[model samples]
Target: MADPTLPRADEAPGTIAAQVNKGQQFTSFDVNAFEIPNQREEVWRFTPFRRLRGLHDGTAVRTADPSIVVDGVTDGVTVETVGRDDQRLAEGGAPFDRVAAQAFSSFTDATVITVAKETELAEPVFVKVDGPGAGEVGFGHIQIRLEAFARAVIVLDQQGSGTYAENVQFVVGDHAHLTVVNVHDWADDAVHVAAHHIGVGRDAIVRHFAVSLGG
Candidate 1:
């Protein structure tokens, strides 16, 4: 099924015609450039503002140090943690919302995973992000790239307690085949919000599956 948050191409002509600013896109993040969501905008209308724990606004602080583990490494795959200022960070899509902007501004480091061209992995790459319990709030960013003709599968597992917001980006090169699975299993009191952006190159094949078992 298509994600409800994304616009569908199969909508009726009238529905498409009813859209305002047909060619306009959301504003890119600039920290001071975006306004905090007030639950009135289209993006926030369906979100529970109170449950965000100030993630939508500037009141949230990064009080917890989340643990990240990468397992099942295979040949031709590379994983590294880098400062947010890394040039590769800009290769992904820009932030289109305040929360995304906030996450970018708040996070000091980012994780990057790269699959070399023409390389096919026999085992799935597993990335686990575990948050510390309590009322802490945290922010994070992750980027995954598959070079041309690369074939791989990745699984992201998120768990534990906290108010966390994150932005993830996937870049698929020409003729590359990439599969991603995201599993969210959080503590009952945990509050998490995330945005995922994907850029598919010509003739590339990309598949994404998401499962939310808890929150």
Candidate 2:
């Protein structure tokens, strides 16, 4: 089945997907909703557009699909790959940036991690997300959902090479506790643009850590 989030027939297959703007006024699942960023824009003034490897301008086409796998499944935790139409997607929030929206609207599938309500895992779940290759480009998304009163630790190890853009959502349920670590260790020439959207629920606690091993 075609994922609802993917571009429609009239829409270019992988380009111009996003409705959000520079001012952050509105958001949508459509790609044409966003304007391509240039060196002149305030939000983009400091970004090296050339270094993006065409992800921002829609010139980069996905050369490969990302490979996501977990070290092991712990009790009370379920990891599944779901289509973009999955209701659980974007639970934390909608795409707030053009790149983020593009990633959301372009990805065919998403990795969803769910911690059952009130269940605590004995060990952390390690997820490894690998990109296509050094010269390739790809778009992807991942989501972590914690049910009410649950507690868990997650380690996201992102590696491999390529020009990659992605969005990650963390939805913490009421009274749940979550701690996450994200490590970026791509090849020296690789390019990556990513957004991490976190939504903390009532009485929920979340701790996040990021490590960039490659400059």
Candidate 3:
């Protein structure tokens, strides 16, 4: 039998960021809406497709509980409550292809976390995503930004009951330093998909580490 799930032979090389960005505009690309003709594709080979498919058959987006803890000295970093106007929360962009945009629409209401200007935070800012239902699926989105000369550490904890998908985006300013640690601790039956977009300005340094446990 012929392999029906293979990516194109002549796919472009580069990170999704490099391929999607045209000058200053950011293009939207949903990996789930597209097809890969072969498993040799850089991003698709390591992914568990069968598990991912099971997740797609799950549920829709819903309201989630958010827990944020900002510890230690925080003169440089200020946790602000944003009401849906942040650029990281903007919608409608050219997808990696047409199919993605048509399949998965952008979510509404993303928690915007910001590190203020000239603020050098000592400890880490923890953001935890939790849900209420069991054997239930949920969806959530988050956005983070750091101003010029600011420095901070951010830990994003993604956890759910049954199965879930979370969309996250980040922006770092010039001369800023940001260290992000993503910890995914979910139930064995949970299927979680996290999408991250990070933009590092000139002279900015952003380090990311992801740790996953269970599923």
Candidate 4:
């Protein structure tokens, strides 16, 4: 189906940003608030619906728990698994789309990583997520926070097989520097969709690098 509200001829490509602003906005965990995508919306237009394995339409269900591991822990860092109601979950930002909202709504636990102020890590933190298996669909959420003047580097490594949707949020405090690298190396049949949101504070430096080797 074609989009009913197409951009006018006079509208420049830059107008896309305004479309993003005008799109659905939700701050709470309610999947019912967002409409199911029909491949007409900006976000779903480019996505491969068949590859999603019913994640967008809500037919997918979690079959097995994926393995999540965090390595290279430092003294100044704290990591914890918190509930969705935790106040820290809202520190980053709200869900920006249906998949993000679904992820937040479906995930049983949320991972929070915090770097204390004025702390510098000698080694990079590594987060690895391994898919449950084929024919299983999973949802996950992760939040990373860097306190004022903290400096750190984080690497997210994804691999294995399954249909997965995830939301990752990064909040950088003033004068902090955070660099994130995401590496995707999944099985050929794996389907993974992830959205990343970053909130940078005054004078903060944030860098994101993505490397995809397989799907």
Please provide, for model 4 over 86-157, each residue's C-alpha lDDT reduced to its tens digit, 9 standing for 90 to 100: 887776776656777777778878888999999999899999999878878888888999999999999999
Report, for all candidates in order, the number of backbone clashes.
0, 4, 9, 0
In candidate 3, clashing pairs total: 9
Candidate 2 error regions (>4 Å): 1-25
Best by TM-score: 1
Candidate 3 per-residue C-alpha lDDT over 160-187 given as tens digits, one digit per residue, 9 for 90 to 100 = 5655565566788899999999898876
* Candidate 1 positional error at 95, Å: 0.6
lDDT of 4 at 24: 34
Q: Candidate 1 or 3, higher lDDT? A: 1
Error of 2 at 2 (Å): 34
Query: In terms of lDDT, which candidate is stronger, 1 or 4?
Result: 1
Give RMSD (Å) of candidate 2 vs. truth.
6.1
Instruction: Estimate the TM-score for candidate 3.
Output: 0.67
Q: Return the TM-score for each candidate structure.
A: 0.87, 0.85, 0.67, 0.85
Worst 10 residues of 1 by lDDT: 11-20
| Location of the lowest summed lDDT over 10 successive residues in candidate 4 | 11-20
lDDT scores of the candidates, listed in order: 0.82, 0.82, 0.59, 0.81
Evaluation by TM-score, superior candidate among 1 and 3: 1
- Model 1 misplacement above 4 A: 1-20
Cα lDDT, model 4, residue 127: 94
